[model samples]
Target chain A: MTEILFYSLSIIAIATSLLMIFHKNAMYSVLFLLACFFSIAGLFVMLNAQFLAVVHIIVYAGAIMVLFLYVIMFLNMSTPITIRKSKLVMFAAVLTGLMMAFLLVVSVWQTQAFGQHPEIVDQNIGLAKTLGKVLFNEYLIPFELTSILFISSMVGVVIFNKKEVEDE
Target chain B: MNELINLKDQLRIIPLEHYVFLCIILFSIGVMGVLLRRNMIIVFLSIELMLNSINLLAVTFSVYHNDASGQAFVFFVMVVAAAEVAVGLAMLVLIFRNIKSVDINALNHLKW
Candidate 1:
């Protein structure tokens, strides 16, 4: 049953992700991206990472995609009819993508080592408490730094947005 | 045939590899979108797709090892993603205001 569920959701995710890439219409691509995110979140649930599943839905599906949609809608931009009007840009994009993919494959092939973790947690264990304890205890500084990073990013956005307005 | 089914069953039993492979495919698709798409918003959506793919892998590894730490990392990822979206959308809006288009090609004006 779990296998079936995993395969089904995985298929959904892959399919929508493909659509997200290939769709000519930007809005349709965003919508497909949302579907892909939702399906991945569902997969997270099947993996027994309930906390991750919930957060995935809220963050990607609920917040990020919506923000993309809002910006697209506010901008009222149309999809570019010719994606590759310039041969140079097209070649660059394809070459970069291929190079990155090659690098990723080589790295994965080279570093196939995985840590041997004892399966003590199990599917029944709730992740939130354990995650919180470790995050606040062991990885405290990094966690706080991440928060600061977010705050600075927010400020940067405000400054940029304000600058754009002033220029107008 | 019987042995094949037994092996298939064993392989398909946990579906660990299936999740990982699916995530890889999804991540590549997202990468292709980010690379090939001209629209900035769609590119951003593709980035979110890539992030979600990583999140899927993280959860899968967490479950495979029965560790809660992976899921916890996913939580921080989500927090960062939310903040990222907020900032990204605002920037997109500003960019749109200046250029009236969200095409990546147009972003070259600031390349200097």
Candidate 2:
């Protein structure tokens, strides 16, 4: 059962992400990416990261994708005119991506430690209660720092979007 | 009978290599999206996809090692990703307002 779930979710994730990249329509790409995010969330659940799965859905699928759709509509770029790049550039991009993937896979294959599956020591490690304890106790500083980051980002967004005053 | 097989045992049914390979595939697709697409919005989406793949890898390792800290780290990553998208989209909006286009090619004045 676990194997079936894992394979199905991974297939959905890979297929939707591929569609997201290949689809010419910006709106369709956004929707396909949303599907990809949902599949990833499912995988998170399968891995027992239940809290992270919920948060992933809420943040990526719920908030981020909505923001993307809004921007697409705001810019009126549903069907963007494709500026055709030369065949050479397209080939180079695909080649680079493939090379990167090959290098990563080779590195992983070389690591003998990765072949040994480690047993999960704590069954409840993914639970929110356990994670919250670790966050508040061990990671308190970084957690607070994230709030600072958010505030700064919010201020930056406001400044960037603020209307410029023109002198008459 | 199902209660006899705990969640941990069920999770162990899938090998770690499978998760790693899945992340690799997702990350590669994201890289290709950024390189192949000219639309700034699509590029941003690609970046998000890359971040999501990393997040999944982190969570997978966290579960494998039974470590709460990795999960906590994933939380922080998500927070940062959200802030990044907010600022990035705001900037994209500003750029669109000024240039009237979101194509990366349109901003090639510095490409001398």
Candidate 3:
């Protein structure tokens, strides 16, 4: 049963990701990418990280994709038509993807998958409570630092995206 | 529920190598998008895809090790990804304001 769930969701992820790439319209790409996120979230759930799954949907499919669509619309009021790359460039990109895939898989596969894990996950380490404890305890410093990063990035956005009409 | 526990047991039946391969393919596809696509937004999205692929690997390892640190890192990844989109889109807006197109090729010359 889990196998069925895993394979199906992976297929959905793969298909949507490809469509996200091949689609010319930026809007279509955004929409397809949303599908990809949803499937990835499903995978997360299957992996027993339910909290991260919900967070994934909220952040990626909800917030980030909306931002992408907004930017796409804001950039050009009309529909966005992507300019095609040269055939040679396209071939090179495919070749690079293939080569990188081969190298990464061969190297990683050589390493044993991981340390011994119980056959059954049997624990709720993925639960929000467990994760929160870790975040607020051992990783408290990095957790606080993340907030600083968020603030700086917000300020950077405001500065960079300030409308220019006021300057005129 | 008993069924839920049983389902998790089924998950254990699957080995970790399968996930590694899946992530490898997904990450490669992301790299393909980043290399092949010219639109700045698509490139940004591709970068997100790559990040997601890495997050999958991280979470998988965490699950295998029964550690919460991996999940904590996932939180950080999400935070960073969010901040990046905010600033990146802002830059995109600024670029569009200065030059009317979002095509990376058109913006190639530094003077423009």
Name the best candidate (by DockQ).
Answer: 2
Off by over 4 Å in 1: A78-81, A86-121, A124-126, B1-12, B110-112
- Worst lDDT window (10 residues) for model 1 chain A? A112-121
Name the lDDT value of residue B82 in candidate 1.
79
Q: How many residue pairs clash in all the candidates, one count each? A: 0, 0, 0
Residue-by-residue lDDT tens digits, candidate 1, A1-168? 555666788788778877777677887877887887788777666555566677777767777777777666676664444565777876787677667656665555555454333434353543577667877887788799888988898899889877866877
Q: What residue pairs are clashing in model 3? A: none
The lDDT ranking, best first, is 2, 3, 1
DockQ of every candidate structure: 0.41, 0.70, 0.67
Error of 1 at A35 (Å): 0.7
Q: Candidate 2: give its CA RMSD in angstroms.
A: 1.9
Q: Write the per-residue lDDT of candidate 2 for residues A62-138, one digit (tens) a residue.
A: 89999999989988889755734788888888888899989998888788785665654566778888888999999
Stretches of candidate 2 exceeding 4 Å from the true structure:
A165-168, B1-5
Residue A54 deviation, candidate 1, in Å? 0.9
lDDT of 2 by residue, B52-100 (tens): 9999999988877777888898999999999999999998988888898
Q: Model-by-model lDDT, in order?
A: 0.70, 0.86, 0.84
